[model samples]
Target: MGPDLWNANYDELLEIPLPKQVQLTGFADDVAATIVADSAEETELLVWSTIDTVEDWLEQHRLKLAKQKTEMVVLTRQKRFPKPFKVDIGETTLTSTRALRYLGVMIDDKLSFREHLESACIRASKTVSSLSRFLTNTIGPRTKKRRVLLEVVHSILLYGAEIWADILKQKTYRRKMAAVQRRGALRVTCAYRTVSEAPVLVIAGAAPIDLLAFERAKLYNAKMNGDNSNEARARLKKETLCEWQNRWTSGEAGRWTERLIPDISVWLSRKHGETDFYLNQLLTGHDQFNAYLFKMSLHPTPTCKYCPDKIDDAEHTFFECDRWKDYRSSTEEIIGARLSPRAW
Candidate 1:
């Protein structure tokens, strides 16, 4: 806390424990110690000892502990003891809390993600509202608006989704994500609140929350397990996708993530990356023509804006619209075959 004693710069002046004494980790202003135990009493002693070591180390370095700001939580499937039970470090009685934050994540004793999901949704919604002005009036290129939705709102919504993939289980949490996605789609398509999300998503070329979260989990798992060694990094480029998918299907993520994204490699490929439109629509399923999130009311309307007689949708806009008559005839003639626009 004072000068980092473990730091290489001060290693000569100050010495710390060898790695075997206790697993110690510190960064910035926070420090943590870990120990293994075989019983509840042993676990309590170990935790207190670990905390004491950290406190003593700080004291030696002339940094005092902030007892009032310090708190602890025991993480387990079963509450080891009642809330009244306490563990003491020095004169401070360390009480168990319902939740505590670690590395920016709010983790409760039960490990449920409801709190985290709610926090993320609130942050994302605020960001969307703050930056949504750019989405109005078509001031810049469509790509700019798309970037705001993806980089700002989407980034916050999907933060650490891979580590907490269990969020898929909570209906309320998943609904929060869906709600935010729909809001973004509304901005993207400039559709009225009563409009259906199906066409709006298609027009916006944006991926839905479920698929987006699963894809993020897949990528996160891959990065966490992969090694930094050059040999590991360079392994089998030709079959990397195949291997990754195979490995993913064997893990817990395989249970549902695989179904969400059938073609793992193609989803990860750069085939559509060159163009945001193609990327969102084709690979990410962020593009048009699906009714996955539409409701008859309180959702976006599904009527075609250009041709009021037909449903306004991706399929109609691309091929079946009266407006595309000339282009459609030329396309058929060029292909030298009569094709249904339903080929999509």
Candidate 2:
């Protein structure tokens, strides 16, 4: 089918009423729709009517609904109980599943992102293995290979991550994502998988996926806060960020007196590419004068090249180095940020 014609017809057909509860989430030959109800009976009624409406709409549009491919899956919290009945769609009964792959995300009945995380990890691993030859560490000439790998891997890893929260959630998913990132770093840098991936990531200018996700989530939260059109949305959006931050500060990172989250995501989005690159280096502590590497005896000298008196480490260079102290002071005054917990 031609793109324009198919899209026009599908768009027209999808606007049909599928009951008040069921919502049309996307428009296409393939759509992911949802319906929420209080009870099984109400849900069933809505589902039945939705199917009927879809069928009638298809008929009116002179297009046939593919009964064989059509299937329905209901997500519920009842783990031990079997579905009392099945949803009938023509001759085929729609099958039920513990997990549903919607828009490339695997959402299980529990609303946990575990399945999606696992799926993304698997896809990322396969990409790493399949494209090993492209390693100027994952990309080469003009960043073509790197761009392709990122477009595929990061897209899978961070899909819908804007909705990520910590409450009633597990840290295992973050660990898993970090593990995948470490593996990619090792592969690209040709380091032993067991070795620390920090240096490799820094030298390669690669940002960890978990950090990237965290930054993106913060950006999404900021955007929601700035949106003023709808009251309900604003409240929910604010609540989402507040809940996540509260859980993070109180539960997992309670020891941290100052907020660990920098407004760098917003900065990255608005700033130049070079600035973004530098910020990542700063956050990861993996810039040109990497002190930790010198401690490992990877570099010839640990002393600051600009100021021979002071050790040129991340902390010193970025904060206390004699050479940059003036610059750092001016920067702090301008941004109104001290960049340290004890600096105040």
Best by lDDT: 2
Candidate 2: tens digits of C-alpha lDDT, residues 160-274: 7876534113567777776666666554444434345444343234555555666557666766778554654556545544444444345432122122232223322443332
Give candidate 1's error at residue 343 in angstroms: 9.0
Off by over 4 Å in 2: 78-81, 133-152, 164-169, 221-344
Candidate 2: what lDDT?
0.59
Tell me the deviation in Å of residue 194 in model 1. 3.4
Model 1, position 171, has a per-residue lDDT of: 73
lDDT values for all models: 0.58, 0.59
Output the number of the TM-score-best candidate.
1
Q: RMSD of model 2, in Å?
A: 9.2
TM-score of each: 0.61, 0.59
